[model samples]
Each structure stands twice: as C-alpha cells, then as structure tokens.
Target chain A: LQGTVTRKWDINKLLYANNIEPEDVIDRVYNRGGDESEEEDIEEEDFFKKKIYKEPSNEFDSYKPHFSDIEMLKNKWIFDNNNSNIDKEDSAGNSPFALISRRFILSKKMIGEDDS
Target chain B: MAKPSNIVFQTHRNFRIRLILSTLSGKPIKIEKIRSNDVNPGLRDYEVSFLRLLESITNGSIIEISYTGTTVNYKPGLIIGGQITHNCPITKPIGYFLEPILYLAPFSKKKFSIVFTGVTSNKQDITIDGIKWGLIPVLEKFGVRECELHTIKRGSPPNGGGEVHLKVNTLLSSPLTLHVTELPKISAVRGIAYCTKVSPSMVNRQIDSARSVLNKIGCEVNITSDAWRGKNSGNSPGFGLTLVAESKKGWRIFVEDIGGPGETPEDVGTRVAYQLFEELSISGAVCRSQLPLAVVFMVLGKEDIGRLIINNNQIDSHLVHLLRDIKKVFGTEVFFLPDDNVIDQNNENNSILTVKGSGFTNASKKIA
Candidate 1:
C-alpha cells in the first residue's frame, strides 16, 4: 500500500479519467521522472511545465483543460479509495465542506444499495 | 362621364369643408354624389379625398351649400387655408393641503393633481379644538362655506390627528381663471404660528375671549399684526390663539395672541384642541352620523443628527414597535413624519413640534 505501485496506479488513472490528451500529461510526467533520475542541475526553464489558459471569447471554442500545478486531483482516486478504510465520521466532523461530501457519499451508498 | 379627380387630407373633429366648381365655358358646374352599386374600395377612398378637398376650400367662409358630406361642414375657403401654424394646450391643476386643517382650493391654473404635507411651526402641542377655533374662523373669513371633518377610518374612534377638509365654494371672476388664492389666508396664519412659540393655555384663553367678543358684536372684524410667538421677552407674553367670534354688539371680532414667558404653548394647544374635539363629537352625536378624524404630531428637534420625533418618539431600530405604540396612543390611523436630519445638524437647545389634526378619510395613505 505504500510502494511505487500506488504512485503508478494513481497517475495512470488520473491521466485517463481527465482525458489529459495523453501526449501532454504523460510527456510532462515522463519528463519530470527523467529530471528526477538525473543528477544534472536543471534550470527552472528546463523543467516540464503545464500549459496556461486564456479566457474564451465565444461559443464553438474548444474545451480547454486546466493544467493545475498543485496536482491533488492527480492522486484523487487512489487517495480516496485507500482513505475509505478510515473512519468517515472523524473526517466529516472536521470541516463543513467534508460533512457535505460525507452526506453525498452516504446518500450515494444508499442509492447503490437500493439499485442492487 | 369623365372621372372626378381624387384628393385627400386629414383633419380633426369639428372641421369644415367647402367646394367650388366652374366650367371653362363660363358656366357653373353642378356637383352631385355618384351612386356605386357595388362596394368599391377605391371609390370610397376617392370620395373621402374629395371631401377633404372640399373642406380645404370651404374653411372660414360662411357659404350656403346645397348639400355637404357628413365628415365636412361647408364654409368659405378664404377664411380657411393659410401657410401658418400655431399651438396651445391646457394642463390639469395641482392640489394643496392647507393647515391646521386641510382645505381644498382650486388651483389658479390646472396643472396636475398634487398632494403635499403641511407642518405647523407652533412649537407647543396644540389641541384639536384650539386648531378648529384658531383655523376654522380664519377659513370662514376667506369665504369657506362649510367644512366636513374626517377621522382615520370613517366613523372610527377619535385620533388626535383628525383631519378637516374645508369645502371651499369661493367663486372666481371666471371658471377659466381658477381662483384658489381667495381662501382665508391660511398660509399667512400658519407661517406665523409655525415659526412662533406660544403657550397652548394662553392660545385657548385668547380663543375663548375672542369668541365671546365676536358674539357680543354683530359685524365681522379683521385683526392682524399681533405677535403670536413667545414674549418679545415684553408686555404680557401674548396668546397664540387666533379666532373669529360673533360679538354681543352685532360684530365679528378676529382675535390673535402672541406668547409670553413661563407658559407652555403645547399644553394650551392640546386643551383648546380638546374643546374642538368635544364640539365635533357633539355635532356628530346630534346628527347621528359617523365622523372621521386624525392628528399628526411632527416634532423636529436638534438631537443626535436632528432627529424627527414623530409623535414624541424617535425612528428607533424597531419600526413595528414604534408603530404599535403610536397606534395604541393615537388610534390606529395616526401618522408621524419626522425630520431627524435637521435636528442632528442643529446643536440648538430648542426644537420645533407641529401637531395637526385632520379627517382620517382625507389623510394620505402611508406606503410602507
């Protein structure tokens, strides 16, 4: 549960579910992996960077992806699945937003049971 | 037969039309209406146009015609057509609220209907009776024939702010020239009373004396130029009560009082007002009719930012509470208009309060 397999599984699914244009997300991830393995002192400019977005003016404009620097969403599925084992009530009482999410999850579980 | 030429013109109601036709052979041609067996739209249009032309020709001329179209009356053309134009229009008249009672007067010129609030400058609290005596007689002098007093709800309980709507039958030289200015000079009296400070007690006493004096006399008297405000800080501080009384000697005496020191005009005003209220009540009882009346107390003083003390209270945070209190004391129909801004701005120790009573039915409805 605490190994490289966890990291590999999370990044792969995040890369697919977000439809991150495989070429862009993977290329950046691979480039970052390469920089980590190498001992070379890479300049900030040399590091792989996510794309920035500009405001869309009108309809028919292509859907643009947000290349967020803080990639919490990159490991969202793995983090959530693993944390499922933790007591939800403890986390829910910590914050109001979490309480809302906890209620949503509970309602969804109830609906899933009804469907089954 | 050759077709007649078609013409068209637009005109307003009460327009006249005329026509003249001459043959080239030096003989006059007779004009006659053509009968159309079928419904011809074009023919109808042509007939209308011909009538317009006829109207254009006959304007202003007093000419006799054998027959004319329903749309046009025959007149002389010489008086009708010109290359010039002019414009004139009439507007509706505005209304005013005269105090301490509200009297209806025709506007000098009709512009638009208007409703305005009037506040008495009297600093003391005046009563309904005092106001009736102080104000009614003056209105009678201005030629007000009769007055109908009103309360909040018609025939409802008495509220100090009862309203008085004076039926003004002052005839003007001509209806065209609406004459509203002839009503007893209420503005003049109100102007003096509102700005001046006089005790309510003295005002009532003066009104009583004036009533008796006029009762003793048989002729009408016009009294003016008495300082109704508190003491010149000199001579017996005058009474603020103004009244017209029938004297035992067959004369009407118009009496007014200015004020003096050590007397509260507010108390006197309230007392005199009570006298009028009683009289009104008696009149209603005798007639077996319901009377509607209201009293509005507008107290403007210098406090924190010139608070407008409406009915002796501030516009505190809880407005519903304030309204409930007012309703309990002055009947459900009373209203208070405050001027807190003026009070807050002025650092003066003295403040001005106006207590006005009028018929309730006539009072303007307040929009929350």
Candidate 2:
C-alpha cells in the first residue's frame, strides 16, 4: 500500500503540477552540470594548482573563504565520508593530487537529485 | 551592565537582516562595501529610503554614511512607535518594508500606525496580500492581537502609487513559545487574482488556469477575482495572482506570480498555483518564505526551546546569515538535525531546526 501511494505520486506529476516538462528539468540539470564543470576548471587553474599569494586588507579576510575554497570544502566532506583514498591514482592516468583537485567536477555527474 | 562593542561586517548582502538585528539588539554596527564592484553602486535609493523609515520610528538613533556611500555606521535608538507616513521607493514592493516593521511593531514603545505608499505586488518580492493573509496570523500565534493590515489602493511595479495601512497594538507581557513539529493537513486554499488597468478578462483567465491546476489535487480553492480601473489603478498595467494555503493548524503557505511584458496571464496563474502546490507538498510547519521571520521571532521570544521542522532545500543564504547574526547579537545558538530514517530517505527533505529564545521583553508597558 505504501509503495502504491508512492508510485501514485511520481516526478511526472510534480512536473505537471509545476507546469514544467521532463525536458525542462533535463535541460536545467544539464546546464547546471556544465556551469559547475566550467567553474571547477577555473578554480583548478587559479587556486589549487598554483597558489598566488595576495595581500589581505581587512582582519576578517582570513575568515572569509573563496567560492572555489567552499567548493573544495564540500568535496572534502563527501570524500571523507566515502572513505576514498586521496592519494590513489585514478584509471584516467591522472595523479592522485590531480584527481583530488578535480574531484568536485568529476563527482558532479554522479549526483542528479533535483534541488527544486 | 557593560556596554557591548560594535560589530563590523563586510559586503552588502542581506542588508535588511543586519538592520533588523541592529535595531532589536540596540547595538552599533559598521557595514562596508555596499555594492562596491557594481557600476553606479553604493546604496541604492531604496536602501536609503529604508534607512529613513528606520530613523522615523527610533529616537536618539545615529546614522552616518560615507561620502562615497560605500559604508554605513548605525547606532540604534529606542523604538518609539507612533503614526508615521513613508513613501517607499518604486524599486521594491511595500511588502519588503512591511516585513521588518511587522517583526518590530510588537516590541515598539507605543502603538504603531504606519501608512506606506508604493508598489503593492510585484514579481521580485512578497505581495501585500501575502503579508495580510499569511504573516498576520503568524504574528497572532506569538500572542500578538489587534494588528491589522489593510490595502487602500493596489499598485504594481515601475510606476507604483499604491497605499497600505498597518496598525499593531502592544504585545503580551511574555512572548509565547512556539513548537510546530507536527505536519497539519491543509484545510483550505484561498487566492486573489487581481488586475489593474488591464482587461477584466485577464483576471478570469488567471483564475481559470489556477483552478485547473489546483482542482486536480483534491484541494478546494476559493479565489476572488478583482479588477481595478481608472484612478484606482496605478500607472502601470499588469495582472497577478496571490495564493494562500491555510493548514488545519493555522499555519499558511503563500505563493504569488505577477504577469509582465512577455508573460501571459495563463502562465502566471498556472505557475502560481503550481508553486503553491509544491509548497503544500512539503511536510513542514511554516512555508519557505516564512522561515527567516520565524527564526528571528524565536530568537526574540521568551526563554524556551522552539523547535520547527522545515524543508532542507528551503534553507537559503539569507536564513543562514540571520542565524549567524543572531549568534553574534543575542548569543543564541541554532541547531539543525537532519532526518535519519533510511526508509523515508527517498522523500525526506525535512530537517529540524531548534533554538532557545533569549526571553526578550518590551521595555515599555501599557499602564492600566
């Protein structure tokens, strides 16, 4: 009975209620994935791979994290929970460090839950 | 008691939240970098107008803006409530200004009678109807009675010339503690499909489309269609729909959509109804938009643990920032407990947010 109730209320029904098509959700997810990947690429090129030191103007500067830094922190939380070795070389022949750096970008494709 | 030092913050994010906290805590604050990177930046006219309104209600308040308008130093004064008239800027709807005022009105030194003239409903912010239908009851939940919000004129965006009157009486001696953990069944759905300086047929189209979407969900909706013309209508021509879903427990979920240049009336109606349906589907005490207001009141209420179940997805940056500000100003901590049931994992978007109130009491009491 629970399964029947669950099946009765499906994603298509939600989409219909919201006046959105399945294609729209697909397009939105795809576009979000693309944007995340592009942002990760930029972060990898700028912050992690090459550490450029900048002068801090305010006392609170140390407490503030960059967008890329926040992304890295979220990725680290997921990685620590998954018990994935950070130093292991991936099948793509990328070094462990390189894989860790791009972990957020690569993991983006695996998580497809709708945030709406 | 030792005087508290000033709190310094950077950036222009959540300006209203910071101002509300400062006013309630009676603490001085310095905020720098008000949209510094943007072109023609540093405190828009609307923000300055909001500050002026704040000044009108408070006594001995000190506000200093830098020459570039990139920084502000504010020292809050005693909240002295009385009759006041404010012309809100056209950039924002009257709801934006009314929200913080509602939060502060109960604790005011006297009765408050405010006349606000501006845009009543718009796409960007909450509408006046939502506040009257949704938030007023939430205020009453905290033991506040005799508060009224009435719309004298309906206004839309751009060329706004709307008017709304708000009157809130003094609050109770002790703030009532609230605990809304149980999900209540939706009792009824009410809405207003309003159009001004537009075709009367547009309102019917909106109502029909909205009914089409809501009637399918086994929820009965009673919608009132309103059409204003001539001098009563504002400068702009537009139509919008505002829907409020009331639960058996008296909590409300409010949703609104306004038609603009390209959007059709049918789209506005369907979208607003769908949004309301999505909100109703969430098993929580309050709607997503009311989360911040609830948290703020919880901090200001009598000393007791207030617990609420809210959707995890509804947590926004503004709510997070408000939580942090509460910690800094009131020394109160908020905890989030995620639902851990594996069986309900597929449908569990609800999380529990708990906080202890600071037992704040209004300084001025009415004499019998």
Candidate 3:
C-alpha cells in the first residue's frame, strides 16, 4: 500500500482545485466579457479630477506668428513636450510653421541625431 | 484660399487610420463615439464590413450611419480602384481587411485587385502571413513595384473560409524617401509553420518547435512547413507561426503565433520563438508592427526629412491617434528624437521620430 502524491496539478493548482475564476476561465474560453460590473462604472475620482493644460510661461518668449493658436498650434504641435526654449539663432525667415517651430527646438537639443 | 472643411473626430480609434487619411486628404470626416461605452453598442459587423469596403472603392462616397451605429459621416470619394471582392467579416481578419487595402493600394486609380475571403490567421490581425512576409517588403521600399500577395486559402478561427489575392502598383512619380536610419545585421530566420484541419504532424510539430527556439538564437532559421488539404483547408482546426526577421539592410521583423484553445505545438512553437526573440531585441528602424506603416510613409513622403528609429514603448493608442491625425490631416509635424543617452540613463524605450513630408502628390490616374 503506497500512494501519496498529495495534490499538485497546476494551471494555478487546477485553478485552485476547480472553483475556477481565472476570470471565469477566461470568460469561458474567450467568448470574453469576464464582467467586472462594466469596470465599476468608471470613476476613480475621475482620474484625479483631470486638468493638465500648462504651456504659457511667456508663450515661448514672444514668438507669436500672428498670435498663433491654430487650435493652439495643433495642440502645441501634437501635445507639447517643452521644447527647451526654441531660439536656434534666428531661424532664417521662419514659417513652414516657423520652421516647424525651429524643428521642435532642434528636436530637444539633438542627441544622436542619426546615430553618428 | 478657403477650402478645408469637415474634420471632427472622437472614439472608435484608428478606424482604418481615419478612413485612409480621409481618402488621401480630400478630407471630410466626422466620427463619434462608436461602441459608445459598450454593452452591445454599435458599428461592428466588422465595422459594417469596413463600410462595405469603403463603399466598394469610392466614387461619390458618402457613408453616414447614425441610428446608433454611434455616428459616422465620412464623405471621401474619388479613389476609384478596380476589381474588388470582399466578404470578410467573421469578426475581423483578412488582416482587418488587408490593412486599409494596404493604405489604399498605392493611391489606387486602377490596378488594385483585391479578393479577401475571411479570417486568415487570428490572434487579432496582421497575418495573411504577416501581409505576405512583412508588408510586401515594406511596400517594396515605398516605390511600390507592382505588389502581389496570393494565398488563396487557409482560413482559421471558428470557421472562416479564407482566400486572399491583393495586387497594388500605382504610386511613385516621386514622393517616398523613407530613410530608415540603420539597424541592419540579422540576415535570416524566415518561417511559415502553417497547418489546417490539423495533424500533418501539426506542421512538423510547429516546425520542430520553432527550430528549437530558433536554434538558441544563432539565427538562420528558414522554417517552411504548411500542410493544408481538401479545399485548401478551412472549416477550422488550427495551428500557426509566421516569424520573418530578415534585415541585412532590407529590414523586416513580423512575428505572429496563433494556435489557440489549449495551445501546444510546443506552446505555439515556444511562443513564436520568444516573439521572434523579442522583436529581434529591439534596436529599431521601425517594428512594432511597422510603426503605423512607417508613420504613413513618413506622412506621405518626399517633401524631405523622413527619419525613423522607433520603439519608444511601441507607441500605441493607435500610434497616438495617428499622431493626432497626422496633425489634423497633413499639416505634418511629428518630431521627437529623445534618446539623449536614453533620456540620461533612465532608459525608457528609445526614441527618434522626425518627419517633414507632405509633398504627398499621387494625383490619381497613372495606369500603364
């Protein structure tokens, strides 16, 4: 009489010995909608009360191309990233949108500009 | 000079890169919250069979949709490509309608040739052999030399059917200057592995467990197994793989995996060889599903300055809403760079994006 393998079947121990719920077995094998009550009807303090508009610390020191604002220059050229004081020494008669706002301030002060 | 109307957007992200950049920027969009907070919301028989394959390749296109398809609108006419043949909607595949017909098949005015039955490989998109080995050689490096795709059968998922065809060859009267900025050296590692109504030794046990984990990373894979049968195998019983790699200057990467419901052809060949060795250990020149077709061919190429170097955490949210709809439809901005020694040692995904293009011409009708 020798028999003792004492339980170890894994897939997280046979999903915890079959009370299952790995998102109800991945929502019954992927028909999907493992319902978490429609994600608790969305409200984690409305993402900490949203609001992040920033940009005006002297709007790039008077670089106003006709008081720009083509929707804030297309949301500061697709979502502002603080191009460190763009002034690449008089961008020779600028405007292809001010030479793409001085090539977005020389792409944040060029770094491996073309790796070499 | 006035003329620059409609262009409001919202939810239902990258809906075919905003209808192929609003049919190549004649503009007119509208969109609204599709799947409006879903609980069976709207717009989904594969987005109304991709708006009936964009109202069968445009001509006085209008579109509309709103009695709860959660708003749409569209407009975009004139892109009159020819021979179409869709069907594709078993909940999306046929590489989600062959990736906006490979971005409006080289600005179609003629030779486009589609076909497309349904579901050709799953795990959510890009797998008609990763658009025939990584997007027809990145649309033949943008000159688009008479493309072709083929694969007339081999569907998967619950009961698809599968077919394929594709053609392309139109653009190039100058425009398309890519400039991939070096990251070459991975000479080989091709693949296929396939399988159909199962057991053709599950495509040689998923190509001998993806060539024993791509021969422990020494590369030179060269897969190839297939198996298909009867009516070129469809009504379900899967298996998959794909891979790609390539490099030696002409780049590629791809990856795919498949084999669902209790997976194991050695767990879909060691998880598609560790996702093609984590996308060839990412030292990018575009790969992250070809960074939105290399940012829509560097925002419709040739105005110049078109650099690449990708991987910044694989940018997603549909490549940040296609870079804010390519700065609201081609005013073209894109710039990023970053990598000042990976932002001074914090090392978050590398960067470099740059762009300037907008010399986007393809004025249609160029057949011969």
Candidate 4:
C-alpha cells in the first residue's frame, strides 16, 4: 500500500489468513493426541494383535516340508553305468567260442569283477 | 602202464575201421552187434580183442577181419542200410559230450539237431519253415558232402525242446598205427598266490615273475585271466599259467593254478586240464579228421603232483595216484589244490605256496 510496495507479510497477517487461532490448533493436534485419548485406544488394538499373531494348534509349522521332496540332481551316477541291453545283445549275437577265444588271448584286459 | 593200442580193419564194403584206445577208470567194454563170423579166424576174444587184432595186423603179419553189410535180398538185387555197431572197450563214453555242432541260428533260443548224414529220420531233420529263405541252406549246402539226396519228409514231429540226438560213425581211410607214447607234456608248476586285496598290477607282476622262472626251466608259458570272477571275500583268486613249448623231445605244456577266488586255483586248473584232455579224447572218440595228442600237467617245484590223463579210449586210473603223490610231496605248502589234508606237514618249511580251501575259516592274506 506504500509508495515502495514492500512484499514481506507480518505474523498477524499470516495468522488471520489461516482462519484459526495458533493456540487452539496446537492444543487439539499435539496436547490431546497421546495414548490416553479415547479415540486412540492402543491397548485394545494390542489385544486384537495378540489374538491374530497367536500360534496355531500345530507346533512344527516351519518343519512341514521333507528334505527329499526337494531334489538335487546328480549326473555321474546315472550316466557312467554300463549299458546292460547292449551287453546282452553282444553276448547273444557274438559267438561264445570266439568270445572265449578272445578272452583267452586278452585275459588281462578282461579282469573286471562281475558285480552287476 | 602200457600205452593204449590202436585197432584197425577193412570191411568188404570198402568202409575202414580204427579204434585207438585205453581203459577208463569208469565204464568197461560193451559191444552191441557182433558175431563170431564177424571176428577174424585166429584172434583171441577177451579184453581188447579189436586192439589185439589191429596190433597183430600191424606186426608185419597180415591178419584180416571181414565184415559184410547186412544185405536185404530184393528180386533185382540186395540193399544194405541202417547203422553198424562195432564193439570195443572205451575208457568212458562221457567223452562223446564234447562234440561241436554247427549252430545255424545262434539266437534262436532253440537247439537244433547236429546232422552228420542224410535227412532220413524225422528225429534228426530240422526245418525252419517260417524263417526267411535267406536263413535256411539250399540243397547243395547241407552239412554232409557227397550225401545221397532224399526228399524232405514235411510233417516232422516237433522236437519238444528243439534239440535232437544223433549218432554218427566216421571211418578212417588209412588207419595208420602211430603210438603216441608221450602226451602233450604239461609241466606242473605252482600258481601265483591270489590275494583278496591285491591290486591287479601286483597280480600281473607276480604272474610275470612266475612266468620268467618257469620259462627259464624249459617250461612253456601261457598267461590267461579268468572270464568270470566274484568278490574275494574270505578266499583268494586263483588262475593257471600254462607254458607250452616245443623241444627236441616233443611238444610240452606246463600248467599251474593257485586256487582261490570262490574256488581254489588248483580246482579250476585241474578242471581246465581235464577239459583240455577231454577235448582231445573226444576227438579220438569221434575220430574226426584231426585228433589232438594227449595232455600232461607236470607239477613243478614240488614232490607231489596232480595228473589228469585222458586218451581216446579212457581216463587213466593212474591219475588219482599221480594227484595223491603230488599232494604227498608238496605237503601243506599248497592246500587248495586237490589234497588229502588241509595243512600238509611233510614239508617242515611249507615253502611251496597254495590256496586255502573254499571253506577256509582263516581270513585270506592280502597280498599285493
């Protein structure tokens, strides 16, 4: 309103624009908002929390899954074994006398134990 | 013991006869079809009659025995057929089981007849009807050469198990009498110790050493491993190293096995020795085109030795004595081989190595 047109607003002017007393706002928002307030009943909330988080009748909830049910694959044991069908085919198709003869000649090579 | 004599003769039908024989420890002589007229004029007729006849003929004196085909008189002429049975003593007829047959279909899961002659009987003929034409042989491809062709009798009774029994007689053309006084000499040597926990490399080394020692002493060496083997739990693994060599004297073979591995080395070795001789004997029994000479297993480094002697005609009785003597000489040093007792005490040192019997209570020593 002055000839210089100063822009800064005083405290009284800011308080009037908000349309509420500073004392009344502070008393409602901070002073009366503790646990003691009837609207903020934290103890009743804590009772319901305890009931929801309570343990079920079963005790081994974490131990439900079996170790074997989850598989860890291993390839050596599966692939390294001898082909039994091929062995059977060779024994049946090949000449027994020839096999015996070969065995006689290369006996050192035929030293494997008959486990399978 | 005197060597087995050879029996030979010629039939009027141009068929030749020869029997090289010895007495078996088991069965005696039994003849099926023969008559006094069939016997030669001045020949003795007890044991080894055929042998004596052949011997007399070979003695630079000609003694001939005549046999005629059983002829059937027809209006046009006479015909002769069927089998002719000759009587002679055999060591044992068991040698016949070793005959090798031509297996047509190795995977047929069925055994067929071993036909040596014409397809005259239903029991001997094998027909592969459903099989492809490529599988069966043509007329000219039959097993017999110069065989008389006969029409195939179609409706043959099913050979229950598809196996047929047959009898074949093979005559020698030039029945020469060559006395095989000495058998294929087999040197009996101690087999290597088969240890349960020993590595294969170790066994190989032992075999090599044993072989070198044996060969240095003029024993021929043949090293062969077994085909099948199981866990050597309380027993050792035994095998034989046969050394076959030729010298100025004759062909000689030496064999030894240290029995263990479920069976004793000697057990397996002796069995193999018998089998080799049996094969030769069977060849003699059938009188196939080729026959193997006798096999002798000479036990070395030990006073006691085991011998399994088989000829064309019989398994010798001296084999038992020879085996017994071998054990008595070696004493307890070698156990698993055919022995009278488990622990031989005659040799104070018990230096000769041997395998414990199958039922050995003491745990086998682990040798590498």
Q: Best candidate per DockQ, number? A: 2
Q: What's the count of clashing pairs in each model shown?
A: 86, 0, 1, 26
lDDT of 1 by residue, B83-113 (tens): 2111101010001112311222211111112
Instruction: Give the alpha carbon lDDT tens digit for every residue of A56-106 in model 4.
Output: 211111111111110121111011122111332232363222222221222
Q: Give the fraction of true interface contacts kept by model 1.
A: 0.00
Worst 10 residues of 1 chain B by lDDT: B86-95
State the DockQ of every prediction.
0.01, 0.03, 0.01, 0.00
Give candidate 2 regions above 4 Å deviation: A1-116, B1-3, B340-347, B366-368
- Tens-place lDDT digits, model 2, residues A4-44: 11112222222222233223322232232235334322321
lDDT by residue (tens digit), candidate 2, B1-368: 98767888666666777887888888899888876765665877877888999999888889999998989999999888899999998988898788888878887788899999999887656788878877787887787878999888888888988899999985555567888665545667789999989999999999999888666444458999999888878878889998988766678877777897898998888777766655554426777667777888888878889877776545543345556667777778777665662123433556667788988877654656
Which has the higher lDDT value, candidate number 1 or candidate number 3?
A: 3
How does residue B39 of candidate 2 score in lDDT? 68
Estimated TM-score for each candidate: 0.18, 0.75, 0.32, 0.20
Docking level of model 4: incorrect
Q: Where does candidate 2 chain A have its weakest 10-residue lDDT segment?
A: A59-68
What's the distance in Å from true for residue A112, model 3? 32
Computed on C-alpha atoms, the DockQ of candidate 4 is 0.00
- Comparing 1 with 2 on lDDT, the higher-scoring candidate is 2
Between prediction 1 and prediction 2, the one with superior DockQ is 2
